[model samples]
Target: MPEALLLVLMAVLGAAVILVLGLVAFRAAGDRSALAPPMPAAYRDDATGAWRRGTLRFVDDRLALKGSGGLAAGPWMRGNLDLGIARPLAAAEAATLGRSNLIQVPATYGTSTFELALDEQHYTALRAWVEAVPPGWNSQVA
Candidate 1:
C-alpha cells in the first residue's frame, strides 16, 4: 500500500510540473491581442485628406484600416492610401508612415504583421513604388 501511494504522489507531481511548463511557454509566446490598446476614434474620420487609420486587433491577428468615406468600397481617389500588412510592418518607410498613424511597431523577436489604410490614389502610388524597386529591396525590418 505504501508503494502504491508513493507512485501516485510522483505521478501527481509530474503532472503539476508539466502544467507549469506549459503556462510558461504560453507566456513566452506573448499573445499580441491581449496587449493591444483601445484604438482612438479620432483617426476614423472620412474627411481627413490622405490619412489612413485602422485597428490592429492583435488578438485576432487582423489589421483593419479605413479609406476615404471610411469604407473599403469607395471610389478610387487621390490622397488615399489603404493597405494591410500580414507580416510585421517593416521599420522602413512603410513602418515610418504607420507610426504617423499611431500604429505600434511589432517587436522583431517574433513574426508580426501589419495592415494599412489609404486612398485609392495613394494605394496606386505605393504599389507602383513597390513594383519599381528591385525584388528583395525592402527585406530589412522597417
Candidate 2:
C-alpha cells in the first residue's frame, strides 16, 4: 500500500511540473517581445499546413527571415534567422506542391532548392529579387 501511494505521488508531481512548464511556454508565446521586428508578410509553411506570417529583412545583399509569426507574439526557435541568402538570386519558378502554391528558387549558394509558399505580394518580391541579378552576372540556365 505504501509503495502504491508513493507511485501515485510521483505521478502527481510529474503532472504538476508538466503543467507549470506548459503555462510558462504559453505565456511566453504570447509575449510581443518574443517576435523580432520589421513587420511580416503571410506565407504558408510548406512543411506544415498552418499559415504563418514572417518578418523578411533584406540587408547587406542578403535576405533574412525573422519572426515566423507576424511581428506580434510567438516563441521563436534558436537560429531561426541565422541563415540567409547571400548570393545573387537568378531564375525562379512558380509551382504547386500538393495544394500549396510554391515558388522554387534554384539555390545559388547551396545545393538544396529554396522553396516558399508566399502570398501574391511576397511571391512578386521573391521573383523581383531573382530578377535583380546584375547584367554582368551570367544567369543562363545551362
Candidate 3:
C-alpha cells in the first residue's frame, strides 16, 4: 500500500510539472501575436443576428474572434482556439455605429454585417489598424 501511494504521488507531481511547462509555452506563443492584445467584445452573428461574447485577436496579419469564458479568462490562455470569424485586415471596413463606441463592419459576400462595441482606447486601436497606410507606397510611385 505504501508503494502504491508513492507511485500516485509521483504521477501527480509529473502531471503538475507538465501543466506548468505547457502554460509557459502557451503564454510565450500568445506574446508573439501581432497588433493589439486580445480585446473582450461581442460580435453579431450573421445567421441569427444575435451577439456572442468573445475575444478578438490580431495574429499573422489576420483578425480572429474566439469564444469567451472558461480557461480563456486566464492570462496564459491565448484564446486562439475555436475562432468564429477570422479575416484579413483589409477584407473588412470598420465604421462607428453612432454616438456610442459601437463599431460596425459591413459584411462582404457570404458574410453578414455585424457590430462590435468597444471602449474608446480599443476602438481607436482597431480603427487605426484597419485604416493604416498601405504597404509599398514608394513602389507605387513611378
- Between candidates 1 and 2, the TM-score winner: 2
What does the lDDT come to for candidate 3? 0.52
Off by over 4 Å in 3: 70-100, 109-115, 120-124, 131-142
- State which candidate has the highest lDDT: 3
Superposed Cα deviation of residue 65, candidate 3 (Å): 2.1
Give one digit per residue, the lDDT tens place, for model 1 in 1-142: 9999999999999999999999988855643333244232112233222335442222232323333464532222212233333233234534535443323221111232223444333444444533344445447848
Candidate with better TM-score, 1 vs 3: 3
Model 2, C-alpha of 23: deviation from truth (Å): 29
TM-score, prediction 1 = 0.26
The most accurate candidate by TM-score is 3
35-141 per-residue lDDT for model 3 (tens digits):
66787665664534555666777665455666654323212112222222443222122232223344434333223244554555665565565545356533656
Q: What is the lDDT, from 0 to 100, of the residue 128 in candidate 1?
A: 51
lDDT of each: 0.39, 0.44, 0.52
CA lDDT of 24 in candidate 1? Answer: 80
Residue lDDT tens for model 2, 33-138? 3223333333333333443445554443445555443343222222222223333212232222232344322222233233334444555665565556556454
**Ranking of candidates on lDDT, top first:** 3, 2, 1
